[model samples]
Target: MLRTLSIRDVVLIDRLDLTFGIGLGVFTGETGAGKSILLDSLGLALGARAEARLVRGGAAQAVVSAEFDLPQEHSVLDMLAEHGIAVGRDEPLVLRRVLAGDGRSRGYINDQAVSVSLLRRIGDELVEIHGQFDNQRLLNTSVHRVLLDAYGGHGDLLAAVGAAHRDWRAAVDARKRAVDALEEARRDEEFLRHALGELDDIAPEPGEESELSRQRQGMMNGEKLLEAMNQAAKDLGQGRGVERMLRDAVRALEPMVEKTEGALKAVLEPLELAQENISEALLQLERASQRVDLDPNHLEQLEERLFALRALARKHNVTVDDLAVLRETIAARLAEVDDGDAGVRKLTHAQAAARKAYEDAAAALSAARVAAADTLSHAVMAELAPLRLGAARFSVIVAGGGDADAWGEGGWDRIAFEVATNPGAPPGPLGKIASGGELSRFMLALKVVLSKADPVPTLIFDEVDSGIGGAAAAAVGQRLARMADEVQVLVVTHSPQVAARGENHWRVSKSAAPEGVRTRVEELSRADRQEEIARMLAGERVTDEARAAADSLLQGTES
Candidate 1:
């Protein structure tokens, strides 16, 4: 629902702010009283393109803000969230639009700046407006089937069909991709044979790259280790300096054993044993470092071996360990190419099944639409009679195509709404056949019937009743009142009867400012509304008769 609209320096609306309620709101005024200025300003707020001419003469820019109470699941709220605009669930979405005299425009949602296109997208979701000389949506044949379904309250079933259709299409697309891949692989059968043969010949293994490099290093340094080993051997057992020293010590200890007795003998024997053990360890270390190979040919071979592995790894753009995985994948692809027909057959079968499921769902929805169209046509016709279109013939036509092009949600056939103004004449398209007044009446009937199902939060009708009055006008007013129970309805009307039906009423008038003009709006009290209605009924005069008629009009509905 539109909670409020504020305008600043927009055409004749220098500054205006108005709060709204759930039920019907009527804006009434005489010619040149700026009723249309109000609508135009409101339109600018609802994402209409900016016009420099609409800017007040003294003002460099114009600004309009529309605040809407959004439902939890509204698509606009999702869009806002996606754009990083924070709006609480069930919170009012305060959309603001500003227009500069240079023709630049800006928009905002919940105080966060937004692009104009986004505002247009979000605005479209929140409000639906119909007007004279404008292309009203209800008259569009393309959407007639969906509208009929909505009128019949089949939104859930349509939603189910939509989900099923999307899933089916996705499956079909996946199968197509699989089949395409299989076909492409068949063209590479010979290449696969060659590549796999090469990989199989090489038989690369994980960890082989690091092992080869280490082996090459060890072989190159073999001579250096051998030279160091021989020198250490001469110092130990081969030279025998430590061994000679230990022999002298042992002889000295033997003499002490008799002189100092067993205590001195134990200490001397331990020192002699320690020297002998150290000499033996040095001999083992020297022997272990002996030159195993110092051949230049062996080192050359190791260098070549490491280079071969590195070259192959570079050619494959992979570390040697990843070659195995690459080879496996190639083998798989080659196998798939060899069994191309088998894979294609599987994919084709799956695609056929998915397409069949979507078709079946679409066919059922089409049947349901056919049934719903008949009932909807009858209901709308019933509504038309009270609006003085008793002679009009309304139609809901379902076009050709029994099953071939069946689709999701929207069903299998092309659908349209047709009408004939006079009995005996052939029924024609609604927009072409109906006059402005007839269009308004038709739209009003459609809205009343459709509002309960796929309802918009706010509805604005701009002088839709321009050519209707009397009992027909009364019917239009009554239906508008009834629709208010479902959604907020704002009517820019001239009919006294229509004015009387609104739970909330406002009078739109103009005031001249220093630079240009300004629009003013005020909610009317009971007495003021009575006078306004009477004034509307009688131009330039509110006689006793007009007052009495206005009283009767207001009294009859009591809305």
Candidate 2:
């Protein structure tokens, strides 16, 4: 519910502040007294398009702010929270907009700066303005289905349809992915099998290349190594030449030892030690030469193994170390190819089940909508007679069963509020068939019937009593009052009956000021309200009989 509106430098409304309360409030003024300016200010605060002309002449900017009190569970609270704008449960939601003289604008919510689009979205949720020229919400066929569902209280059914739609879409995506994988694997089937065959044939092992290279290096120099060992052995008396000479010298020294006494004893000991060392050296050389391998056939075999491993590595574009891993990967791809058909078939079955679920949920929602449409049409028709629309016909057309392209999360139903202005006339869209006055009355009747279901907390009707008077105008006022029991209602009316029906009344008038003409609104007292209504009934002059009639209308509403 809107609690207050503040306007600054907005056209004729130079600086105006007004407070509002629950139930019906009426703004009554003579022609050109700036009632429209009041609404424009409210619109500006509600994120309407900012125009340079809307800014008062010679003023730098125009500002308007609207404050509202919303329920704790209102969807707008969640929306604000999503945008990082926190609103406490008891805190009022304030939306303000400033329009510069150059047509630039800024919007704020709860004193926090926000984009105009966001402000507009929240404004849409909080207030609905219905006039002869501003019936977009009821006229737009796109929102008709949503309005019908809301009226029918189909929250659970809508949720079910949404969930089913999501599940069906997910299943479709999964099946498409599986089918794509199967097709790709089939295209590469022959290549995979052939590559696996080559890798299996070679059967390369990890580190085999390095081990083979090491053995090949040793074998490549085998002949040179053996020749050097043989030469060293020959130099160290391999044929027993040094050992034989040493033993012969030792024997001669031993025989002369007795004759030479002590001198011969020292020489004999040294000759025996030299002969022992030469014998051990000859044994070591013979053992070393025995282990040297000089066979060319073994070296050729080693080279063949090493080269084959390297050639296979280069052919696969992988090192010898990665050949084993590559073989495993190839085997896995081949396995997938062999099982691709079964995987795709399983996914296809799941997709079918998901589609069935979605169809069932959508069908149920559609059926419920058809039933609710009849009830809503009847309810709205019942309201038409009291508002001087007895000859008119109101209906809710729930159309379904289009092609798959027309299906949506909200089900397949196409709902519209259609009306026929005269008896036997073919019903057409609400906006196209009704005149200015008829459209406003039609909206009022709909609002009266759907008051409890409408989520908007406030409803503003401009020129709702455009052409109706006497009993018809009083009927319009009574219905507006009835709707106010559920939501806040504000009407800009010239009808005395409507003005007298308001729980609160304000008189809008234009006055000449020092600078220029300015528009002002005064909240009328009980006595003041009677005068305003009389002024509405008698025009420029308020007659005694008009005052008496206005008093009676006020009393009738009170009763």
Candidate 3:
């Protein structure tokens, strides 16, 4: 439901604010009293195309905003959620639109910026406005099935159909992903075959690069370490070396100090230990020198292995280990294309299965819609009589053979609402066949039917009661009131009878403003409401009889 509308510097409206309430609320005014201006302001705020002309002459920008009280199940919630906009539970959604003199426009929802297209999409679910020559979603042939299902209470079936459609599409997408991948593989088949064969020939191992590098370095450095270790071993272990000289010296000193003291014994013990340690170290040095095989052939072999890994790395643009995986991948690609017919057959079978599933679900949904159409058409026809189109014939024509691709909300039926003013004439498109007033009545009749099914909490009719008065006007008013019971209804009307039928009324008037002209709206009290109706009845003047007639109209419930 639209809770409030605030306008600033938009066309003739300068700082106008309206707070709407439940039941039927009517806006009444004379010609050029800015009734149309109010609706235009609402439309602009609801994401209609922005126009520089709409900006007030002296103003740099115009702002129009509408706030709506939406429920959980309302379609607007999902749309807003899809855009990542937060809509608190039971919180009002404020949509603000601003247009600058330069023709730039901006929109916001709950203070969060939103694209105009997104705002427009969310707006469609929030409000359905029917005005002079303006047909809302009801005129769209696509939604006709959903309408029928609503009337037939086929919500469960519709959900199932939607789920099936999504699953089928998913399967098709999976198959396509593989096929696209396979096609890309096929493009590189020849090059990959050779590359895989090359890696197969070498078959380099992980860490082989660093391992071979260490071996090569060891072989290259063998010459420098070989001579040094051999010389040290010769000096330490050969005759006249440290071990033989130290042992002889200890023997000589020990004998000379044999009678002197135990100090001579300590020196002898240290010399003996040092000689033994040098002999053992000399043997280890000789062993290490022997391990350094200066065989140049081994060095060449290590160099060859290191260069092989590097060459392969450069050629494939990958490290040596990655070559293994690369070999496997290319081989798999070659295998896939090699088994070409097999893959194609698999994809073909999958597509066939998915298509069959989609077709079955679509067929079921289509049948349900056909059944729903019959029930909905009957329900809508019943609503039309009370709306004063009793003699006029109406039909919800569902043209069969709608493409399965086009099957969505209504299972692909080319639906059109047709009407005939009299029983004998053939029914044509409702919008073209009915007069402006008749179109409004037809829209009202459809809305009254749809309100019972759709989750939208408010319905606004901009001059829906136009070109209608007298008995027909009363009927329009009553229908609006009846529809209001299901959801709030705000009507901009000229009919006094329609004004009398409202549970609440707002009188719109234009006043001279500092800028130029401005439109203002206010709720009407009981006595003042009657006087406003009298003015509408008498036009520019209020008399005793007109006042009495307005009173009678107001109290028409007594009759």
Clash totals, every prediction: 1, 0, 0
Backbone clash total, candidate 3: 0
lDDT of each: 0.80, 0.89, 0.80
Each candidate's root-mean-square deviation in Å?
3.8, 7.5, 4.2
Model 1 clash count equals 1
Q: Model 1, residue 244: displacement in angstroms?
A: 5.7
The worst-scoring run of ten residues by lDDT in candidate 2 lies at: 232-241
What C-alpha lDDT does candidate 1 achieve relative to the native structure?
Answer: 0.80
**Model 1 bad stretches (over 4 Å):** 89-91, 139-146, 220-228, 238-308, 338-340, 398-415, 422-429, 510-519
In candidate 3, what are the lDDT values of residues 1-559, reduced to their tens digit? 8889899988777678888888888899888888887878888888888879888778989999899887767777778888898788968899999899999999999899989998888788778788867867777765765677677787777677677667767777877877877788789888988888778888877778878887788888898888788777776767777888987897789776758766678777888888888878877887888899689988888787778878888898998768777778788888878886577778778777876766676677667767777766777788777667898887877675556666553344566677897879899877678888778788888887778887657788877777657887888888888889889898888888888988888898888867666777788899998999999899987998899999999999425
Please report the candidate that would top TM-score against the real structure: 1
Return the lDDT, model 2, position 56: 97
Candidate 2 lDDT over residue span 48-166, tens digit each: 87789999998999999999999769999999999999988789999999999999999999999999999889998998898778745778898788789999989999999999988
lDDT string, candidate 1, 145-217, tens digits: 7677776676776776787777777777877777787877777778767867767877878887788777677
